[model samples]
Target: MNKTICSVPAKIMRNVVLLLTLLFLTGCWDRQELTEMGIVTGIALDMNKETGEYILTSQFLRPASQSTVAPTPNEPFILISATGKTIPELMQKTNRNVDRNGFYPHNKVIIMSEEVAKSGVLHLFENFQREQNIRSYAWLAVAKGTSARSLLEKHKTSISSIPASFLNNLFMDANADAVSSNLLNFYKKALKKGESPVIAVLSIDEGVEMTPQTTKLSGGAVFDGDRLAGFLNERETMAYNWVKTKIRNETLGSYDFLSEDGSIVALALIDKNAKINPNVSKGSLDSFSIEVNLLTELSEHQPMKEFNENADIIHYLDNIEKQAEKKMKADIRHLTETAQKELESDILGFGDRLYKRYPSVWNKVKDNWRAHFKDLEIEVEVNVKIKNSGLIKGTLLPESM
Candidate 1:
């Protein structure tokens, strides 16, 4: 018995040591060395309409000189482009221009030109989706009125060394009017039955004199089954964003209200609560009612009148709120009509909402939701409340004036 117990301990020790030796001898066969990799910061896909070929542009991080201990920021990137029939072919061509292997984990954004977007984007993204190295969180945008390569080459970056990073950061800004979407989120919505993807629109703003050319994110590109269907202007984009999301720190826009002379009020949205209710009766859809309640703070106003009395200030503020509500309602109405009548696309998630609430109803119209969407009746209600008028109760004009 004693001998058997001793052998068991010895066998356990031998197994443990053998496992340790195997682990120590193992090598990382798939490990990638930094020196052999070229970090890709951005990618732009454009198409030659006449030639029927794709032009892929890749922005790579230019390595800092090894001689400098701490190198200052310089031209931090270089653009390499290639043309081919397929994305894989373009990538292979791009690889010949650089010494190191292309690495995509650090990639910030992927931009597609209007032409490419209009044609279709699913085939282009297939390679990216299959490649395990490419990140799904990379942002996607559509360049409007310019080629994707031109925007990548020209757009000036102030905060980030990589222009792609700069473009990605633009979506985080609360004041941005465009809709924000990443690769994974885009794919999810693109493949969804009732919903569609809305990608942010990037454009170069030409500067006339003292101003330099800058990048602007003002509108959104609407998609229907991977093909670009239409676009939403800045105002319509803002309204759509407000309807889809809860607003915090977003400025809805300036409103003009007549309160004892012409007064222009700029309201900053503090909080928003939005609800989309689909009306259904006897297994048939009726209409969708969108109710939006907003709490805002007065940011600026052209002081056309003085409000010294409490009653006068109260009356003036009430009128401002009413006018603001009216304007917001009209904006929402216009946006809905544009989506239904002009675009014939369901950029809004009305069908998705209906699906989640009443799956049976969605099942009946799933195949022909597009036709239903174009004729769908949507009602919008907006309520605005100005919580505060900043430090001063009335106009900042001096009493002497």
Candidate 2:
């Protein structure tokens, strides 16, 4: 009985020690409350001519005070701009001015103005690369015709709780024709070899009366190495998407086909796939053969022609498929030819393909690939299948039929 009592006293002493330790470690030393930190939703980068410094703009979130009351006609975000030679210095200045410490972990978008991009985004990229606290996958785009700050100011009313959440949703819900851009991938391509960086384009457009302005995200900005080379239209971007981007997974591309009487038919592109083959002859790069195949459904047709029978319908579908194939082939050709002739750069990533598929040939030409790419020849073939006619099965009885 004496031994049992002694053991109980020892156990009680151990429990007391554990409780004291837990008490000591209860609160975090670097604890930060949600209300205390100003969450950054978006960032815009530009160049300041007068200051000869970088213009860094940040969009900070201001959540509603009461859940039931509608937020005062005030915007859900506050946009701030500070000019500094470097990002670190700019951020330090920003911290001193803002009411709360700015947090970037929740950032949604990064916009680089066309002028800033042309000058070289190396410094901006370095900061993003070095930062460990924030997401590396913020949706990156280049703003055309206006400042990045202007675009951010206009890109609102997304209906998400936080500004960051709104931008993330906006990008996710955006049309799939353009490939999404992120910091890491863009920089990796900019720093390394073989491929060029292409960023989605954002531009401000006039909205309805109440909204006043809106942002358009389409097309793309192409970089020859690290410098902004040229802009690609939507058609050109579609061609690039087929060869190098994620278009096949998400978008049902549309094409216009001219009818016999000068009218048009609209077909929706679907289930597309591509195969590229590189040929070499006599120890010199010969040519590249690209084959593209896709399925399409007819959405709208002109009133010019009426299909009289099943054979006529088949003929019409066949003709539509042929036109689509031709259009895709022409588009790919134009993109490659432009890459080779006008841009004089391999933005199509043929060098990387050559490196992978034909390492031996690449080893010989990798150093001078850009020069060779300009003069390189290519053969393209596109095959399209008309899947359906969308609801209208047969011809409307013309009363003559």
Candidate 3:
């Protein structure tokens, strides 16, 4: 009757619950700290021919030393290397030599030796995809005729304090086409039936020590399936960009040509759109047509005769537009021929366009898309308009030569 129930007190139960909660609050088991971990901002992969091993080069940031020092000529970042038979093994081996666990979330770029890329990057990607720390947006590039290790070496300042940031800046330049070589992006495109993958080409100037601006990211490395097929030069790259996207800033690199008036001239593209349309006839792949509209401004017009009147300006503009159109078409044609005949890869998303417009036709050629894309007839038409002529125009010949 005294209610001697065999029950625990509320106070004891509260204490038990608190102790269990405390056990679970031991923090993330795998969480790494910045000070205790090597903050990797860039990574490069290479293959050693003699040893037949995979080489991993990692760039670690030392911000504490950089800002606190007198800014001597020492590298702000430290590069470490390790070799293994595979990418995952290589990474594990590399970590053994490092003072701390190599953290990759901050990695801005991944450079691969040409040999590594040609052999196929699927294994490399496979390991990275499984890691939570790896970034999807980190750029991927192929080093031409050089070890990826050489590129990561601190030979010179590439403008940025760290080489990794410099690599990021090189690819992210506004004047550039704004395309990323991020592995995730490449993988997505590769999986698409009508699209192939392309990564940026990183070339270093061997003439002198590479300045921050010395490393060039002008062209692209095209891939067939998962293996690299070949490369596209700067001009062809520009053309490919045009065919693939609308101008973000409309600025193509400077163009110089001989004007119709027998004078040297130069122009800068400001903005435009490159549109591709695939036409099918009778449910079969027929042809692809491209229409581009461009707005250009005169950068330099060294006319033999001055623009003394508005009509002269009109005449010069017309001649320049025609010349520009011709050059543009030529570039596009060269790119098309190379992709079709030489590379035998569909760098252009033409197949994707075809699939969208003509799904039935796409199904027929989807398996052998590159073959059909190469054989598909294509036409291009470019229209350029000159809208500006600088702050003031004319020759400095004292008004009467």
Candidate 4:
């Protein structure tokens, strides 16, 4: 019994010694300090037309003390551009201008110039996916009528001391409103065989002295396979958002309840869901049916009026439904037409749907999926339900009435 107790104590001492040794040996293997790294806020990619080389632009956040403060102090974001045959080469060139190592873990946005996007982006995007430091959930976008370097130069506004934090917050606000796609969503779309990738487009318009810098979320850029085929405007993007079940809270245009001239009543969407059903016919793809349900509440009313179950009120609701439906359908049609006729790419995951529905048949048609998508038909249906009308029963009725 004494021997047994002595052996147990020896085992405990051995275990404790082993744990202490491990603790002592285990130091930060991959730890980096902010001072040792250049925090990349944004990246821009463009193809040089003259040399047929790739231009990679990166916005590195400079410490406040390093920036010029007087004579119209430029923002803390520094724009560096380098040209190379590949992205890695360009990145090496970017590192030459910076004191610290360029790190992308804090990268908020990746802006692909229209030229690079149109030339083909799969290779560049693939590199991003493979990188260990880059975040998979960073926001991706395309710039309009501007080089990636130019876009980075225009990001002079910083809401906080940390420019990277401010830029990230801006994208978060846009994502919540369904105006942009986050990195994870972009990756899924890019990897899906049947669906073409879509990215948010950022358009910057330089302003005069008084006018503030105009940063507009232009639309969605539709990619066919690995190349950009077309773009959607803001309205069309809204429709695309509806199709993707991305919208959180948005005002679905206004309706006149009592009178056409009365204050327009608008419904704010609280929740939404979208589903796509693909139907096959005669061994060929027939059509895709998209069903969208929106739960909304009355957010704003023009003239306060008492709640009534009158015919006019019912008619107003019907009209609102029709108008919203029409707009939504038009948006879907625009995307479909752009994907089929213009881009000749199946930006909508119709190919994946086909594969899931009929795998054996999909194998036969996968090679010519774009051709099949062109011949496909698409239908959209929107169902919106109004739940509550805020604090007021209705808009305030005119005293004269």
Instruction: Please list the Cα RMSD from the true structure of every candidate, rounded to 1 decimal place.
Output: 3.0, 3.8, 3.2, 5.4
**Which stretches of candidate 1 lie above 4 Å from their native place?**
1-16, 65-74, 154-157, 174-176, 246-261, 391-394, 398-401
Alpha carbon lDDT of residue 66, candidate 2?
23
Candidate 2 per-residue lDDT, tens place, 97-167, comes to 78988888778788888888888887667776687545778888888888888866634554554444555
For residues 1-401, what per-residue lDDT tens digits would candidate 3 score against the true structure? 33445345666889999999999889898777767988899999998889877888999887665876465566678988988877678778878887788888889899999898888888778878887568788988889877787777654646567778877877776344334468788888876777778788887775646434356566788998788899887777778777775455437656666655577877787777778899877887778998888777888766445556787778767877898899888889988899999999888889988989888888898887766877879899999888886634456568655
Ranking by TM-score: 1, 3, 2, 4
Q: Write the per-residue lDDT of candidate 1 for residues 219-329, one digit (tens) a residue.
A: 889998799988999888878877885443446544444444565677877677888889999999999999989888877777646667778877877888888888889
lDDT ranking of the models = 1, 3, 2, 4
Would you list the C-alpha lDDT of every candidate in the order shown? 0.82, 0.77, 0.78, 0.71
lDDT-wise, the better of 3 and 4 is: 3
Give the Å shift of residue 399 in candidate 4. Answer: 4.3
Model 3 TM: 0.89
* CA shift of 233, model 3, Å: 1.2
Which is the leading candidate under TM-score?
Answer: 1
- For each candidate, how many residue pairs have backbone atoms clashing (under 3 Å)? 0, 0, 4, 8
User: Which candidate, 2 or 3, has the higher lDDT?
Assistant: 3
TM-scores, all candidates, are 0.91, 0.87, 0.89, 0.79
